[model samples]
Target: MEIQHHVSLKHYNTFGLDITASELATIEHENDISILSEVPDFSTQSLLVLGGGSNVLFSGDYAGLVLKNNILGKEVLKQNEEFVWVRLGAGENWHQVVLWSIENGWGGIENLSLIPGTVGAAPMQNIGAYGVELSSVFEYLEAFELKTGKIAQFNTTDCDFGYRYSVFKGPLKQQFIITRVILKLSKHPTFNTSYGAVAQTLEEMGVEQLTIKDISSAVIKIRQSKLPDPAVIGNAGSFFKNPIVANETLNNLKTEYTNIPSYAFDNSYSKIPAGWLIEQCQWKGYRKGSIGVHAKQALVLVNYGGAKGRELVDLSKQIQASVQSRFGIELIPEVNIV
Candidate 1:
């Protein structure tokens, strides 16, 4: 374990916002966690657990310790004729795990390729892309409880997954650090090619037969073209989640905005595309000072250069307000604002 004081966090987060932490600690292995409970400084101090830092925006300097989870490993825990279960270290990069699964003929997470962040953070937001979510393949997760300093394993049901939400971000927020996640993948494959531009991309590539690897490759290519690389320019992917509305409310909006793009989730509710709503408001390519909506994708908030976290939040609030006033829908911030 290496502990440092007053660390700058500009490089850790995808947003590239410079923030300071009073103290920073790195635990390189899972066993190092056993010694964590004895550290009075943590309970005595404010603490934040950070993974790959792709889905968070720091509002300001953190007043206490920032625990950087460096623990790493991935292994197939169990396998049989019917199914295979693999356990992943929380610190492992999520996209790497997806690639590994595809390489090994494990076929559930191919659609999730190229998503940024660590495996530990995946379940926090039930991270999804295409038509698959972590919850769809989740077996269980082992988490270390912050208050009790004890270990607890939560099954899929315990995680209580919903669109862009899970127990980790809700009732259990900041109460646990996920150490490991188990995923049940398939030996027999099922491919979902129905979402977004996936089918079109495949067609353009002249791909007649698709495998898990092919799907992963296509998704990666599509994502790279749409999202700005955090390494080049600063961004945290989609800033707001697609808002879910009651069926009645959706119908009412449809009357005024007849071409509103929506997908039915259940009999009583529908999910409207937030990007479409923002674009309709003419927010795309709209720049306000140093912060602006991504010219290519309305849902992505970008840092043009030297923009502060508050500026991003204010712009997001304006979008939220505009969407609500115009469509009678409240947009939810998907990026975790710390």
Candidate 2:
């Protein structure tokens, strides 16, 4: 394990907020977990287990130890007639994993293509895109318990997955460091192009007969068109979770707005698009100082150049306040603010 002090975290997060960690360590192997636990301040100091840094924002310099997961590997564990079980290291880039599955003709994660982050972070938020979520393909996971220094395993039910939420982000938060994820992907592809602009994008690409690859390509194209690349403009995609409201609330809103867009979330609930609500507030393309909402997608909050983490956070709060005032619905942040 290599440990450093007072490390700049500017490049560590996709949001590009310049901050520092008082102490930082890299876990390149399984043994590093044990070594990390032995640190003098392990029990007393603040600790954060980080992956690709794609889904987090640093409000200021992290006060304690930051363990950066660098564990990497991917292997097929077993395969049956219908599905193949594959285990992936926590630190592996999510997009690379998606492309790898596509290259191997494996299906199930095609709709999640181009999402920035690491495999370990996926389960934390039940990462989803297009019409599919990680829960649909999750089989199990192995993690290192920080408190006991033991390897623990959890299945789908143990995860307690909800839309963009999981036990990892709840009861198990900071309790274990996810080291590996096992996914059950289909040998036979079932394409889901039902969400967002997927079907329209596929049609525009002239994809009459769809394959997993085709679906992935269409998703990539649509995302690229709508989302600003982090390399160019720093951002964590979809800063807020789509608010789910009672059907009666939807009816009331529709009576006044008439153009409200929503999807049936359950028999009694409907999911309202956060992007639409933000756009309705006239925030799209809105800029102030070094932070702003991306013109192409109001769901994205961006760092134009040198925005501090706290500034971006304040901007998000402002947005939330505006949306709540306008629609009487609260928007919850999807991005983790440190």
Candidate 3:
């Protein structure tokens, strides 16, 4: 294993914080995972496995060993008339996978087009966009247990996927490193365009016939128009998850705010848009010394340039506090702060 010390991680993360890792290693193959336990001070230092680094916020220099998952592959394991099972390596780029699926006429992840990050990370957070989520197509995933150094398989039920949450982020946090993801895509897909401006965007695009490719293009266009590109501007997509509040809380807010937007989460709960709450608090387009909330999307926290992770974390906390005070709904961060 090649280990580097004091490695700058600005490029690794989408937030572009110039943090350093105490030690860094690359997991380019499954064999690399077996010997990670033998690395210098492996048992003493904390371990962090990074995929595409699109969903993480480093609060400061990572005072631990950072392993970048570079193991890459995409293959169709099996296929029938209805479904095609595709297995991807942990490091496979998510959007590229969507494009690849579209090329092969496979459908399911088309609506998730342009979502940044890696395949292995998808199951951890149950990545979603438009009206579709990873759980709807997830088959299973293989992971390497850190303690045992053995590979184990987990099915959809075992994952326990919830809204932007999975068991990996909870009970099994830091216990295992996901290595592979298996998804069952459809040969003939049932398109979902009811979420957001997908249908409207498709109509504007002058698309008369709807296909998986058309939906992907529309979702990509909508995302591009609303979200700032990380390549040009530093951002980690939506920094906060929409808070799910009690139906009673929603009714109480409606009486005062009168324009509170919500979606049905369950019979007893409703999901409030975090962006609307932040915007109502006058945080949209708010910037302070190279760090601030994105103007177009309040859910995104961007680093204009030369900003520290600590500042980012502080801003997120402030936004959370503001929303909680104004609406009595606590906003949870979707970004994993390390």
Q: Which of 1 and 2 is ahead in lDDT?
A: 2
lDDT of 1 by residue, 1-338 (tens): 77899899998899898888888888776666668668766677777899988999887888988889877889989999978999899999999999889888998999999998899999999999988898989999999887887889999899999999999899999889899999999999899998869988888888877888888888988998988898877899999999888999888888888898899989898988999999988899899777889899999998877889888888888998998888777889999998
TM-score of each: 0.97, 0.98, 0.98
Stretches of model 3 off by over 4 angstroms after superposition: none
Q: Candidate 2 — which residues are off by over 4 angstroms? A: none
Predicted candidate 3 versus true structure: per-residue lDDT over 219-274, tens digit per residue: 99999999999988899999999999999989998999898899999899999999
Sorted by TM-score, highest first, which candidate order results?
3, 2, 1
Model 1 segments more than 4 A misplaced: none
Any residue pairs clashing in model 3, and if so which? none
C-alpha lDDT of candidate 2 relative to the true structure: 0.93
lDDT of 2 by residue, 240-301 (tens): 99999999999999999999999999999999999999999999999999999999899999
lDDT of each: 0.88, 0.93, 0.93
